[model samples]
Target: MKRWKIAGLFAMALMVSAAPFQAFATSPEFAYTAEKWASLRDNKLEYGEIADLIHEYNTTVRQNELDYQEYKGKTSTDIAEEYYDSANEVSERIRYPDDDSANYANQIASALNSEISVTNLTEQGDSNVDDGEIKRLGYEQQEKNLVQQAQKLMISYYSGKASLATLEDAVTQAETAYTQAQTRKAAGMALQSDLDTAAEAVTNAKASLQSAKSSLEQTKQQLIIMMGWNYNDSVEIGSLPDVDTSVVSKINVTSDIQTAIANNYSVKITERRLANSQSENNRATYTNTLANQKETVSTNVKNAYNSLVLAKDSYDQAKTSYDLAEKERAAAELRLSAGTITKKTYEKQESACLSAKTSMETAKLSFLTAQVTYDWAVAGLASVS
Candidate 1:
């Protein structure tokens, strides 16, 4: 519910952003049609698409398995059918000695059954398959994330009640600044540069608003793609419903990180890459294990390990930054109300808050991915232990 609420809020923001600034007494008219976004959200996608893809992949793998037992029934039937047909032909041909039909029949039988030895299609259940499955799941999870993000955008679009409040503030700021600039110009109290600067600020603010709208639009498209829609297909976003945020705030990042590490696809992919490299090293060592080659292998391992660690650190920093930003925003608001800061300064503070939030979101994602990779590596190491 919280998620939906956030989405609704974002949707409202997007809508406002999509419209003219109204702050300049004139909103820019763009040829933006919300038809696509609306269409997409209205249609609910079934989980069948993903399930079917997985099923097909599994069936193909099973078919390729060289267990021989899997094909026993079909193999036996085919062989028997050939033998019976040959026997009938031989019986008819045996009526004459010149025929050699019996010999031919025996040869046919031998050809069909004698050389029916099973050939292994591949090494059964290699780590590659396991890793691939994990990666597919990871891709699915990424899709889900995109979908949820889209939902957030939708919520943002509809949450006009809240968004209007902020947007109004923005408009007021722009208008007031514009008026101040014009009044100073008329009174010859300010240079043209000052007026221009003020005017530019208003324009920049409009651009920012539009960019935010564009983001929501892009996010909607992303959700469509995640749901397995073609890129060319447009979706309509539905009216967003409110969601509860309590659960979101209550989520334990550390625990979620651990879970992601254990099950996320990104980790599996990295693990697979590392495994392949390790396997190459093993082969190399056996063939011509040189000091330099050994060192190279060690270096590769360290590089992969370092990536995971760096990602983890980035996430941690982002989370901390976000928390600090929240505190700073609070302080900034208070200062503004106390007349210790200008409205422009307050806006700057708000921008900082948004930046901090963005950083935190990015970091959380990175941390989850890193945790997954680290887990995959550790899991592999465990088997060796």
Candidate 2:
């Protein structure tokens, strides 16, 4: 009766031990969904977080690759981390066989298992684990890098000091118009047309404000999408710090144009794509003459260089126009307020001020576009080194 009671307790303990292993074997799968991805990105992720995730995933992939090589009867460069962890834990459980061991114990009733048996038991352990591995992402890295570059572009698009500077000058002009109208209304010294013109300037200012707001939101969305977020995902950016005026001032016609050609992300992309095209062309020509190939390459280089020069010249012109517009707008506003200008003249001044602001924004866009084009062109022709 005592033997049977011991058997019953042993069976109960076996079931209890096996239950956890069974549960672990059937662990739920790791899930990823669009909504969940959005939530995680919002709540737990940042730009740096993505970089860390890539690093960890790369490590796991390397481990898996080594294990795969080992399984294929090849020399692996590294051992599996899991293998080491398991070996350390299971070493304590292993005991050497003894010549005078008791025969009463069942074959499977030993307190510990041998190393070979343990390895066999755990051979399929990885099958049940959710490794959460992402595939080779070299191309994806380029895509991600481009997206990040795009975000920087969008920020510069909206929060540029050039645009802000132009807007401030316009605001001053509008305020001046308002003051002049008020003075004229009070003194009965202003024409009806003058009052009407002043009112129109205020309306234009409000319109300009709306335009800025719209552009800001659009650029913000562009940045969010570039960072690999859904269109509806909310992003709260910290305030933009003042861009280095020194850097801005350091941008000269010749040196900046040259630097932009080399460093602009867009230009680099274009350059890479063009080089890829050249390689494809070379590969396809099984019996082409060396001179012909050289000529073709030369032609491409010339076209790209010319394009860069044109872009640089356009940037220079835009900068001059923007500066001149700012000056003219400010002077016009001052003249209108001093009653030296008639209402019709004041309206013309308001128009000129708005035109200047618009010109400045356009110039900024042109400069960036050219800069990107030049960079991509250079990248096509040369390696990242």
Candidate 3:
């Protein structure tokens, strides 16, 4: 009802920042304007606009890979030719030496001349060494990393937008508090000091709101810069893309760990890198290094899952409190009907119930945010909801 005997929102509302988010269909999440969502769905984004940037990135990386191969091949050919030129060179001093020294110099030059063949010199200083191959492989891996990074940025941008909704709600509540205090003071029921405190709260709430807008703007601009778009400050994005919650029920920690280890962009790149090695030992080294990376990825998944568990627990506690607030509110309503309590006290109880509801919603958002993060870590965006 938003009715309250108090002139201001309880201390709890100002002390705690409510985060707007929804983890599942039943979870509480912030709602966005249709216009904003339309912008995101439309062509407002410049870089990696269509979900994953893998295909476009692959095209650029492939072209660079070809150019790298050409450059390495040319360098190797140049080095081989330099070897041939060295073997063919003769010393001008060979003619002026003592007979024995001159003979020895002539013999040494003759041997180098005899070995002046492409195949023989190339064998000693092969341009097709593992170094060039490894270099190209590294380039490929770097491109893949960029794509993965873009995906993470996409997730972060949407998550921040959700918080913006919470800030907007906070601003409204603060303004409401200030208005109520002014009304109370006019009737001599509230002190000037109380009015001033509410006014200060409104100011703080507005400042926080502005800060949130600026942050969202910064995130949107980052996407434009990364995707090679013209500098634009007025990018509008809609609601977060929905996660595939169906997979949440299918998460197999062991299987997911295996998938991340085997199919992670880096792991796949390193596996391909085995072909870049010239010997068995080098191939084994690459294999072992990538294999060892599995543990780290598994740990990340577990950590994210642990956070989700904690968030769920918090949500449960909030639900219990909300239920208790509902009971208290019902009791107050009955007392008011029986003429056993003042109307102002009943209204206060109603306000407390509303506050409890808001807290419960905030907890729901927290739970959803944690769920999304955990799903992304273990099963990726495809599996997240």
Candidate 4:
């Protein structure tokens, strides 16, 4: 009997240990398990996965989604029915002559009042309003905003990396120039001022590189946290996909403006309010507000398109500059092979080419950001007035 009791106790403990996992598997509250979250933390995070991450892990997005899910298919009438049931329950309890009779009476009164209020509101409120859909859209917009933020941070982080590389090259070039200056000065071929300038360049280059590194790390931290990871969590960040320059040619500004106005969440909300307005004055006010909102959305889309155009132009110019730098670098390499230029001169040319490449990359990132903004505008996710 003692061994059987011990075995039963062990089985009970095992069941207790497994209960939480069983609950988690069946629970509607959690869309992901702890194991899933752990897997996400372990895997490399990519730019394309930001939207899904935000939906799954962002606190605000998760709360909104849960709220929407709870209220889905539940109308004001359903809420009023719930209130009526509470009132009826209180009334039933009041029939019993208990010591808390007076308190139960007050509770019944309050419940009845609440039920009446909800019923009246339901009768007067917009009959066509789908609260669930509105909440779902709100949740979607939150996720979109977070994803956009992550994209911007990712772009800045990669751009900073490119700039850091260019700075590192610049420092090497500066050190080489300083060494050559010292050699020339010793031979009475260069001035002390030249050596001083070279040393200053090296110092400035190192300082810039250090500052860039700090800024990049801060950006990475923000991006990681935004994607549902702890600020200091170590994870590999994948590269941004190549920008689709072809999208630029596909944009139709006029059509896009209409699509933006139609799909804008704020505009939809305002229209709903206008539809539910009881008084003529309230209706007119909301009407005017809705018109203003549509106009603002249109302007935002136009501005985003213009910005994209300017970014593309700048990118093109940078690409031209980079192409010229590449040719010059290639020519310098040939000259070095022929012993026509000193190693210091070749290294300086190499640094210049790197700088040009960094500039081109930075320009491309700017254009990509602009492209994303325009896309968001058309998708009704951009910032309106």
Q: Would you estimate the TM-scores of all the predictions?
A: 0.38, 0.38, 0.51, 0.72
Worst 10 residues of 1 by lDDT: 118-127
Ranking by TM-score: 4, 3, 2, 1
RMSD of each candidate relative to the true structure = 18.2, 20.1, 17.1, 9.8
Between the candidate structures 1 and 4, which one is better when assessed by TM-score? Answer: 4
TM-score of 3: 0.51
Q: How accurate locally is residue 361 in candidate 3, as Cα lDDT from 0 to 100?
A: 66
Comparison by TM-score, 2 against 3, better one? 3
* lDDT tens readout by residue for model 2, 198-226: 88987887788668767776776665544
Quantify all predictions' global Cα lDDT against the true fold.
Answer: 0.46, 0.47, 0.56, 0.73
Residue 348's lDDT within candidate 1 is 77
Residue pairs that clash (backbone atoms under 3 angstroms), model 4: none
What's model 1's lDDT at 338?
99
Runs in model 2 deviating more than 4 A are: 1-152, 155-161, 230-304, 310-369, 381-385
Question: What TM-score does structure 1 among the candidates reach?
Answer: 0.38
Identify the leading candidate in terms of lDDT. 4
Residues 153-262, candidate 1: write the lDDT tens digits: 44444332323334445655787788998998999999999988888888877776666666655655654454444454654444432222233345444454444344
- Give candidate 4 misplaced runs (Cα > 4 Å): 1-42, 66-136, 180-200
